[model samples]
Target: MRLTILALDDVFDTGLTVLLDTFSTANELAAAQGNPVAPFDVRVVGLGRQVRTALGFAAPVEPVDAVRKADWVVVPALNAKLPHLLLKALERTDVIEAVGYLRAWHAAGIGVAGACIGTFLLAEAGLLNGLEATTTWALAPLFRQRYPDVRLDDTRMIAACGQVVTAGAAMGHLDLALWLMRQKSPELAAFVARFMLIDKRPSQARYIVPDYLAHADPLIERFERWARSHLADGFSLQEAAKALSVTPRTLQRRAEAVLGKSPLAFFQDLRIERVQHLISLGEDLERIAGQVGYADSATLRNLLKRRLGRGVRELRAELQ
Candidate 1:
């Protein structure tokens, strides 16, 4: 496979290095295995003659036009204190040119992927419209505001819809690369993950701070406060609406508009988060269930499984 890894000014150092290293390692392993086919051929392309990393280092790169030869164009995440800030900064001529390259490649039927904030650039170029994609969790609000037409899921580590693939968080670059490797050779991808000590990250929801996400809007913030207060007692959307001095319909509308979910769904999300926290503190399953106001441990167990794709044991093992 031939990959064109797009390097941008102030690109994330770790995302770029890890992506290159993954393909390089796969190539080495393929050669060692005496596979008849090569694993990958990678080319680094930049808008300008030179590119700088977020770590204050520079590297030379091929021109934007070089992407035409690639089977896949990989856009690594940007390095920014706040990824939303990076999105605003991306209106520069160099970044816009790179977005155009991505748009052109997509129009020509080539596969395109963006990890973390790189997904924003893809959205900026209008490639993600009508496609399911994922981006960094912290920037989900801004992503939704900017690209309301795109089906954006900030929770999933990887979301591949047709030729447009996206991955969440900063290190999701690895997840995206491994997924591509699996498409080529599932067995080899497993081996590469084991050798590199890369465990599966099913969803980015575990890394989300519910408080921060709620603070984006006043109604959501009020709901967050009500949910937290009622976690031990139980949730009542009707009562919550009364407390917030709004009609139930108004509350439901705001929750749906701001969070893209019903009040009940948001309530369950908070319940699951509390369960995760209690488990992290070494609380036993039964005790956690009682504390989180669940009548039985099985209900909480199933909720964890359904939401995170991991059972209690797997989640606890990760923490330990």
Candidate 2:
């Protein structure tokens, strides 16, 4: 399938550069894979033939008419001084025009995606109101404050529900593009990952960590870090307690009080995360089993199957 992406050249130079580079790289990778299907076709659209950036530079832009023909519309973040009269005036007409195009495309069964502060435009256009979205971590508070109706999840690199997809700050744009590629062509996604030297797969979860333990807990945090560093060596709870200068019973009690789980349970979760990470990186199941403290590959297979509903090979295949 040929995907046409209309990238909005907002008043931000750095953000626009990143968006263009990432989109181009992803498209080139997909094309190089030699798939019979045509890869992505991207165009930059804005208010007129040219738009000035915050840094006093001008980026030539395609007319807004291009958006009407796009399969997907992408709005990069606008870094111009906001809450000002100029911004409000621009949003009243030009910004609204771009957003209206996105809404109309959505009505026509086309997809719309936004990166970082661009989500504000999606929200303003009513495409993201009452939808689960994500943006940069630094701006998440401001986003929630301004648009209380939108559910903002900052933990994920990208969050999408329905037709609107929002990505987080910086490199998360690449993750979002990769996800779109994966949906369009799984084989192309694998080829792109190889071309880009990226080994990890996209995660579907909104919050990898549980909500109850969101607050800072120094002991659990320390233990979790220690477990990750020592995953290859395999440490026992007794050893962990000794490292923390506490008795095993005392450590277990404190862990339960703070994290609402026993020490061993938390350790098991960390082990599972490590094992999954290793498996996603293309580690052999037998080697992963030994590295994560399992007696054999069979035991590790059972554990992974019970926890993730998939064995090692299946998980690896899905990621690759």
- Best-matching candidate per lDDT: 1
Model 1 has an lDDT value of 0.86
Cα error, residue 255 of model 2, in Å, equals 25
Error of 1 at 307 (Å): 2.6
Q: Tens digits of per-residue lDDT for model 1 on 151-192?
A: 887888999988899999889999999998888889989999
Give the worst 10-residue stretch by lDDT in candidate 1.
80-89
lDDT of each: 0.86, 0.67
Q: Residue 81, candidate 1: how far off, in angstroms?
A: 4.7
Worst 10 residues of 2 by lDDT: 206-215
Clashing pairs in 1: none
Q: What is the lDDT of residue 80 in candidate 1?
A: 67
Shift of residue 175 alpha carbon in model 1, Å: 0.9
Q: What's the C-alpha lDDT at position 240 in model 2?
A: 88
